[model samples]
Target: MSATGHDYAITRTLDAPVEKVWAAWTDTESYGRWASAEEVVLDVRPGGAWSSVMVIPGGARIPLTGSYTEVVPNERLVMGMNVPGRDEPVLMALDLTPDGDRTKITLSQTFDRAEDRDQSEQGSNMLLDGLTRFLAAA
Candidate 1:
């Protein structure tokens, strides 16, 4: 759980090693492959930029922009996403722990509104599913 009020928190263990999971989160191509987003542009260092243009199944498009607020190599990441009409940025933190050969990932997201937080939780699940599939195929 985050220090702030985190509306969504997910803990998942991936079969892959910490190195692979960390690469997936930090590398643009790997991230794009499993992020359920298109045209992803990632600059992974602290204070760097990240953005993704999402394309829905029905042809709807949503663009997301954000920056990496903090980076701790393979262990953790802190970031915030920018929403057009929102006053405050949606914050997210990801922590990775190596468990044997697998990696345990905990994700926390804080949203200003409950509704938005609920919606984002579903998307977060989908993103984790995508990452699972991506690892399976590897």
Candidate 2:
């Protein structure tokens, strides 16, 4: 959680070029290679929709869907996450920066409640780790 206490943020640098990183994000097949999802459908544009079916521990597939609020090619993406049972949508932003040959990415999600932010932090970090591994092997 941030000092303001409503956001969960994670930053990671992948040993890959900005173009490659951006391709991996914008391509559904490339995204599925990293994200812990059984299936993924993404349309990367403002007002476009994206969804994934996550493969959880119990073998149950959890559906996560979102709409693209902002998309700036290789630099930034802002998405509104639609979690089941939540009346309010959670907002997430990804900022990508070129760091030499590597790409640094900062991903942050905002929730209405601090408890929700705290609870999602670990999982967010774990997903970033997964992305690093996926990029390394790609």
Using lDDT as the measure, the top candidate is 1
Query: Each model's TM-score, in the order given?
Result: 0.91, 0.89
Worst 10 residues of 2 by lDDT: 1-10
Extract clashing residue pairs from model 1.
Answer: none
Tell how far residue 92 is off in model 2, in angstroms. Answer: 0.8
Q: How far is candidate 2 from the true structure (C-alpha RMSD, Å)?
A: 1.9
Q: Candidate 1, which segments miss by more than 4 Å at Cα?
A: 1-6
What would you estimate as the lDDT of candidate 1?
A: 0.86
In the range 36-78, model 1's lDDT, one tens digit per residue, is 6788888889889999887656888889999998899889999
The models' CA-based lDDT, in order, is 0.86, 0.84
